[model samples]
Target: MIDRRDALAGIVAMFGATLFAPIARAASVQVAVIDTGPPSSAVFTAGQRALVSALSERVIPTTDTPGAIAAEVPQFIEKLLADWARPEDKEPILAGLGAIETRSRRDYKVAAADATPEQQDALLTLAMNDQLPGGADFFDKFRQLVITGYYTSEIGITQEREYLPVPGKYDGAYPYARVTKVFSS
Candidate 1:
């Protein structure tokens, strides 16, 4: 089992932090629910959910391994936002979603969902750049949520990576390839 805190910290470093003022204040109370299933009640609105799904699938598209959608990353994110994320974190999260649309319009002269995949990808790249006005924080937070949710999902653990329930005797001399798929417990 991985320590999620460590995992998040490492992933957060994947993109630099925003030096500007925080768009949304963080809640003192922590409210994350990584366990259980997709939210029983919807957290984001229909439009928001759709945007989240698009962003998630793009972030981790369907390949040989199950993609973010297959792993229920969007649903998981919604649950985290609705049930777990701090109240202050919510506004910025939603703003991040809206920022995609805003960027889409600016770049492609169309709604984010209406933008072509290539165009959307371009916008996402901008988000990743940390140069977009008021969008860097949202991008970092969204990226963290997607990565965390996907890796922790059943499909991510089993289909994407090897999972060992019970280990046999330790084999110090086991032949291993440097590129072997990671195994998770």
Candidate 2:
């Protein structure tokens, strides 16, 4: 009894409804999206993982202090990108990685990892200085994330920075020398 157009519309609507049913149900249930993927595997895309690894190394190299890699900074970035980053932010992140890779390949004829430590440092410095095109903000974001990940790690909080759990119990005023000594030691 229905016209051809009406019948086609009904079929299409049914197909769409069936296709999106699970998604609609999941949204209604409010599932908590968590990153349970293996950390050692390719967590981020190749470009993102490369950038994260490089930034972590640059921020906290293994030679001097325990660096971002040791503190699982790549894992942090992976989790952050999967759960927290906006869709709009992904372009810049990708663009930044591409730019860096291009620069490294063109300038040094090697990938970032294959480059010398000095070259790595120079690339990072240039990125930090906003010298690279199309990815300065991305570099800045990566640097900030690496630093944040490192400083918030168990090693960083207990070892590198002053982390006081209970500040209320301490005296309101203290001498600079005493405070500095307590914090430093």
Candidate 3:
């Protein structure tokens, strides 16, 4: 007794729900998707934001130069996630954040952000050392992405890491110590 239009609508609704369920569950996913070619309707959830914030904090904590939070690393990560990564890859990224949070909560009796610098370092080291629960490959990918994102930022490239764009046309015969000034990208 179902009309063709009704059946089509039901199918569409189901498809939409399935596609957006993870995004809806985590708002950060939408934020990640933002500016990365996804529609504006896709939005990040509280948990997602927390995850992004935590990851950013760990990657580049508040220091004399600047931290990941200040450089908007969360937004950067979100965009990369939505634009560069495949749909199947997103869950692992989110789960990586969740794993860090869960581990922090269990080990330090606090959220990842709430943990001390030493604790944060320990967690990051552990994550870097061991295969994450979600998967070893996913963890490695996430770490690589985070490091790449952090180091590529303006503050990161110029201040934190050595970045040279021109190097004054590259003197092939110049002495190593003579090149004192670094270049910017």
Candidate 4:
């Protein structure tokens, strides 16, 4: 008869092997092309889509790895807003995008997407600090969504962060200095 503890450990070990297997990468990954038709019932307009892309990229810019744009986070956000979010849940995001544009045009005479990187960063900083009226709430939600989308994407999981397959025995005294990229969990 298998003891409960022994059975549980066996099950965990079995699943862990399957779950932590290394991913296979293709030389050219094919991405689905979304329809670029008129926005009759779409959650985001063309301009709003552009704004979301720009804002999300700013949140996770290309450093040593691919950024939010490369990870398709904007498309993820659009799908979430269209399929999952309630009307009330989307109002703040739309309002925030408008506010960002307003601030950008007022300060730099250009839209957020057209503004320089420095200008975009400054605007993001202002929004983050709650200096932009009616924008703080939007920033909080948008930033969370961007991060969630990025971290869940393949580029984020495998490229930006280190992926450890089948973690070894626990070492409580693991040296922080030896740690390079953050481990994807």
Candidate 5:
């Protein structure tokens, strides 16, 4: 018997990461409870957790709206990894994290979590574009996990995207200009 969640995870894993965006958006409102605990415990060590937190924040930084940290994306990721990921799925992430720390220390003379935001952003940019030799694979998975975790989070649904529980009648001719954010049901 195959679990639907596993199927979904496998689907996401198989496709290009960009393909998951609509799925993430569609699944957003269905998210029930977000774990509100210390993000460091099972999947990541304290230092690793800090790195995850820092990296996630850089991935979805705090602008006027709250960022990934506020959405508890790191904790969500920790839970996902501990509960959902297999050993094969886990190894790249672990290796990727190590690479990030290695780069940070070598380039900035500090751990990734302790590096300045600009420095961290630079590292993330490298990973994002596949410039970091060992980091691209990790960043791809990490970014997808972060996004999936975030959109399903309360902050992402309620704040980053708009949510209206009992929405008014739709206007067929509503101007795109009037739209502020993506609406979540």
Candidate 6:
């Protein structure tokens, strides 16, 4: 007879195997995860999309790992805003994006996307430092979304770290000394 505790443990052990599982192709995996695709009614304009894309790329630049843009962070964010964010939450974010552009234009004579990467970096840092009005709130939230979206994406989970499909049993005694980089889910 399977007791509740035993059943729960079995479920957890089974689910845990997926954490180290090899991912499929990037596009296929992305399609599987976001079958609905980026919001059909994406809120941002072409220019706004460009701004967020550039900003997301800056937030998680291409390292050995692919950056936020490669992880499709901006699209995920647009979907979240379209489907989940309330007016109060969404409005401030949009306003902040516009503000960044305004500041960029004023300081650099270009939009945020048009500004050089270094200038974008400086502007983002300045905004985070409370130099821009209400920037702290916007930057913090936007940064978190970009981060979460990136890590949750398939490319981040597979190529960024080791992937082994059907990772077999979860070893309670797996040695930490054997780890080079922390495995991604």
Winner by lDDT: 5
Considering lDDT, where higher is better, how would the candidates rank from best to worst?
Answer: 5, 4, 6, 1, 2, 3
Scored by Cα lDDT, where does model 1 land?
0.79
Clashes of 2: 0
Show model 2 residue runs off by greater than 4 Å: 1-27, 30-43, 166-168, 179-185
Give stretches of model 4 more than 4 Å off. 1-41, 168-172
lDDT of 5 by residue, 134-170 (tens): 6789889999989998888899999999998877687
lDDT (CA) for every model shown? 0.79, 0.70, 0.67, 0.83, 0.84, 0.81
Clashing pairs in 2: none
Q: List residue ranges in candidate 5 displaced over 4 A.
A: 1-41, 168-172
TM-score of 2: 0.69
Q: Taking the tens digit of each residue's C-alpha lDDT, what string does model 1 give over 13-78?
A: 543554787758876677865666656667687877888888888888889998999999988888
Which 10-residue window in model 6 sums to the lowest lDDT? Answer: 12-21
Candidate 5, clashing residue pairs?
Answer: none
Error of 3 at 8 (Å): 51
State the displacement of the C-alpha of residue 116, model 5, in Å, after optimal TM-score superposition: 0.5
lDDT of 4 by residue, 1-185 (tens): 55677576665542332255456755467785664443326778788788899889999998889899999999888877775555577888888888888999999998788888889888888888888876789889999889989998899888988788788777899998998879898
Off by over 4 Å in 6: 1-35, 163-165
lDDT of 6 by residue, 7-125 (tens): 76665542332355555635543433434655767688898899899989999999988999999889888988887555455776787788898899999999898999999998888
RMSD of 6: 10.4
User: Which residue pairs of candidate 1 clash?
Assistant: 31-84
Better of 2 and 4 by TM-score: 4
Task: List ranges where model 1 is wrong by over 4 Å.
Answer: 1-42, 172-174
Of candidate 2, the 10-residue stretch with the lowest lDDT total is 13-22
Error at 52, model 3, angstroms: 2.9
